[model samples]
Target: MNIVVGVTGGIAAYKTVQLVRLLVRDGHDVHVVPTDDALRFVGAPTWEAISRNPVTTSVHDDVAQVRHVALGQAADVVVVAPATANTIAKIAVGLAGDLLGTTLLATRAPVLVAPAMHTEMWQHAATRANIATLRARGVRIVGPDSGRLTGADSGPGRMSEPETIHREVSRMLAAGADLDGTRVVVSAGGTREPIDPVRFIGNRSSGRQGIAIALAAADRGADVTLVAAHVEDAQLDAAHAHPAIRVETAGTAAELGERMRALAGSADVIVMAAAVADYRVADVSDHKLAKEDGAPVLSLVENDDILAGLAGARRDGQTIVGFAAEMPTDHETVLERGIRKRRRKGVDLLAVNEVGWEAGFERAENAVALIGSDDQVVAEATGSKREVADALLDAIVALRSRP
Candidate 1:
């Protein structure tokens, strides 16, 4: 495979050296593209020697070959390690003042970025928006992991280890359209049950996991219908951009159930990943309640079991998977709940994860256990949402392949 590793300015640039070495050891044709500022940390000599491919920071170095565009055009994948805040912003907006920028703009191949910076910068609204923009364009983001940083600072601004980056790149290179010819329906986000015109009941689901699932299936060549309920706009951009995915929105549990039912007939696989409210206010207020009106009486009604309905009505050879987000006292308790839910819902598989004020919901990382029909834990994964998504999909593929 032809690989392009883009190195940006950051202390983590040193780690990218090992990343290039790993790729070269695997017999891949590795090309290193470094920004002028990146060379300050890891010199051009080190990159050139490690990759065994001439390295350059300026587009003028090989103007005759149009190296900037040629490298990107030839690459099977482009990885930017130590992707700094500045570089991230530049890439988000298509700034091509540097060679690496030009190559990035010219690439049609999949792009994976590993971010590294201060926690403040990482969490800033501007950076978040920029990250969202990159995701919208189908760019894969590894991590700015939480840990020790330069001096006394620390948080989610440390670039992922070189080995970690290498592993992800390897997976990207090895990925195939395994889900080709399959039709999948995935419901994501937390449904909003209206209480009044200005307010509603909802969960803290960022819809990142469900969106990751949809993206994973689509990347594997599945035609996907993503039924999203109250998902953030930034998170929805990727699904909307994916040609293989069709995005549909719903507000309440009932609306989500209706959408799922409408799409269920054509789906080979159905995943109920949405956080549907078990109850909704029986009577929605047409106007916002005033403070002087005192507390008004409220009535709650049970919602339909959408997942169970889908599982019960499943066609032969069709697969139905459900998600359970629990606040359990222990790991065993979570698994026990998952098994019971799987059996009760008649689902082929149930992905169970513990959630609380800090653990799940709105976070980038997740831990999940896949409970199978045999009342056994088939797979357990703890990592980024994308990793968990692939694990669930892996179980799905395995279940479908059973004779």
Candidate 2:
């Protein structure tokens, strides 16, 4: 992949050094294009060393090769990290005053911008308009996350982490749009059933798989709504930063259920990937439960069956998918339990995985079988959660095509 990493003037320009290294490590043919002001934060030597390519900020350099136009023309993807307010305004108006701007004008490849500036500068009306203009032209924006910036200032305008930016860029490079024009609703993470203000029953689900699925759907051009519960701060920020995804937070199983119900009707595909608790405390205490009181007997009630409810009420062409996390004793038991769940839930598709202390839940990789309503395994996937998500979506797209 030919990736162009554009670094602009901003204190956050320092972070783009890591982004460049990540792209190079991923085996991408990376070209570093830094603006003059960006060189102040991280010099030409650093970018050249990291990207293993000559770094230049001037359109005048190598005039014979027309390097500015050539770089953009050859790029598979162009990502501008720490794109300052000035850089953004220039791009929005098609100004080609520098190498970065010239390359942007010359290329038709997907462009992603990660903006970093003061909160006030980012939130200014003119900057917002420029962003809107860029987005209107199909440019993807990553983030200016809400956090400490420069000195003691804080709020939206901090650059996203390098890993997050890398993932988004990878998604942009992958080719697929099977779910284009589709509306997808995905539920993720383990819902907490509060016992008291501070105590709750929640599973070890990190929401990685669910968020991966949501991101995968979005990568395929689906309008995605991710209903997340108990996800890590980084994961939450990534979801919010995704241009095609809308995020909704749900703290408890009931809240997740309500959110799913409300979003399911308008969705073409509904994926219930959350580890919703089967039961919640009957009476949630308003105050903290004291440890000095010793163990107390608590009443529990079964939570709403969100998957079954969606499946039962789904429109004719709607696709409802459910996930089953099982801890069967043997390999045979995995499929058996999955088959039974598929039949019982009456869902279009069920993704089943045998999860134990070591297998699933909070793990980076997972193995799952996609079972159809007829109790047959349609597909099986085993890899990083992102790969599995793509596999699952492939099945969903195939199933939706069937009469």
Candidate 3:
């Protein structure tokens, strides 16, 4: 695959050299296209030497070859690492004076931009609006992670690491051919039930499990969509594509339920990892219920069971996995309880985890067991959410392999 690495003026611009090296080592034909300002950060000789291809900064450099046009036409992927505020704004509005801009304008190849700037520049409404426009046009944006910036700053707006950028590009390129283009949806975080407009019932789910599953799926070359509920959003892995992971957020069981059921037909696998509310106040007031009212009677109604509905209503060839968090117990009890829940959910697999004061839900690390049909413990793993996700995916592939 031919990849064009576009470098812009930013502190992290230096990292693109290493990014180009990685792409070259991975058997990709790498072409370097640096902005005039970027050349100030890293010399043309270094880029040319690393890429083993001539590096250029202008569309007018080679009239015969038409440098900008050829690079765009030849590229399978065009990535702009350390895309400065200026560069992002320029591309967002469709200005094509420079080499990178011309290539982006000229080629329909996938464009991935890894933005790097101060937090102020990144959070500015102008930048935000620009990013939204680019995304709407199907252009990929990687990251400006919340970490150490150019100096004594680090909230957000730092370029994602080079490896991540490279990975996202490769994944997008490999998508249809990889995983045979399997569509997978993962739900994460606990859902909230409104008590009134102000007060609501919710759990302590942190969404780590769902993010782990999404990342793990992407790593294994699966096309993953994350349905994130309550809790703050985490940073996405840039290699799969920037803002690498796609996210859809919902806050209530009713909201998330509608969202999940809508995705059932097209999805090959639906991992129900969210912690949904069982009961919701039937009559939620628009205003906050006054504390002076002396504890009003709050009648509750059962929320829709998303996983069971999917299990019962799934289209042909759909696979579903449900997660059940239980109180702590010995291995024997875990197996027994897990198998029972697996059957009760009517899902192909039920992943059981021990949770209470000291287990799953919002916790960084978790130990889990995978219960499949026939009430069997198909797999068990304990560690980071990423590790558990890998184990779960493995069990899924195993299940698919059998008759």
Candidate 4:
């Protein structure tokens, strides 16, 4: 794949260095094109070294070769990271003054713009109108995430992390895969139950699997909504930054349940991959408990079974998939438990995997059995979380085709 990574003038331009490196490492031919102001934060030399391609900012630099037109013509995808309000407005109005602008004007390939600026600039009427104009013309917008800003202030103006930009670009390149027009809702990460203002009960689930599933669904053209719980900042950014996916956060099992229930009615498929807590603190402390105050006895209460609830309340044609992370005595027990769970919960499919101190939680790779409601083994997947997600989606597509 030939990718043109356009960097604009913004503090977030520094993060595009990683985006370029990721594209290069993925065996894509990446060309870095930065605005003159962008070079102030990250120099041309850095872009050149990472992309292994010469960096440029002006159309005049390679007039003999007509490099601006040639680069855009040959590119499979063009991505603009940290696209400032100024840059977006320029592109929106078809201003072709610089190399990046000219290349963007010349490119017929898909364009993905990730805007980053202060909250005020982003919310300005002119900026919003320009974004609408770009979207009306079919330009894909990634995000200007809501979070901490350039200074002590924070709101909706943060650039998405590099991983997210890379994933969105990948999705654009693989356009028109399966799952087009399908609506998918996926839950990820481990829920955190607060015990006090400063303390909480949480698990080791890094949300890798759930993130993988959400990304996979987006890549396949599904309208994806990721209900995330206690996920890492980078992972959360990646989920929210995708153009095809929407992200919602939940801190506890109750919150996750509410989010899932609300999203389920509108979804064609729901995958409960989150490691939700089975129990929560019965009496949450208003203040942090101190060791000097002697031992504290904690009371626990059961949390609502979100997956079972979805299954029981499912509408016709809705497919609900549940995950069973079990610590079992034997290999047979894993399948047995998964089958039992599938039947008990009345879900269409149950993905069962062995999890312990070192197996599933926080790990990069996993193995799972996709057990059907009839207690039959429908399929098995084992690989990196992304690969497993693809396999799971394949099974889902197959199941959805049945009468």
Regions more than 4 Å wrong, model 4: 1-176, 330-332
- Over 4 Å off in model 3, which ranges? 1-180, 235-244, 328-332
lDDT of 1 by residue, 189-223 (tens): 99999899988888899888999999889877799
Which consecutive 10 residues in model 1 have the weakest lDDT in total?
326-335
lDDT of 1: 0.91
lDDT of each residue in 1-403, candidate 2, tens digit only: 9999999989888888888888888899999999999999899999999999999989889999989799999998999998999999999999999899999998866689999999999999999989877764457789879999999988999999888999999877774567989999999999999999998988999998899888878867899999999899887775787789999999998899999999987999999999999999999999998989888788999998889999989998899999999978655698899898888999999999989878888876789999997889999998768768888998999999897
Q: Kindly list the per-residue Cα lDDT of model 4 for residues 120-210, writing each as its tens digit.
A: 9999999998987776444678888999999887999899989998998987676525688999999999999998899889998999899
For model 2, the superposed segments whose C-alpha errors exceed 4 Å read 1-175, 330-332
Give all TM-scores, in the order shown.
Answer: 0.74, 0.62, 0.56, 0.60
* Better structure of 2 and 4 per lDDT: 2
Which residue runs of candidate 1 sit more than 4 Å off their true CA positions?
7-31, 36-56, 59-74, 80-96, 105-168, 285-294, 329-332
> Which RMSD values do the candidates have, in order?
5.4, 13.5, 9.4, 14.6
TM-score of predicted structure 1: 0.74
Q: Which 10-residue span in candidate 3 carries the lowest summed lDDT?
A: 235-244
User: Top model by TM-score, which number?
Assistant: 1
Model 1 per-residue lDDT at 251: 94
TM-score of 3: 0.56
User: RMSD of model 1, in Å?
Assistant: 5.4
- Residue pairs whose backbone atoms clash in candidate 1: none
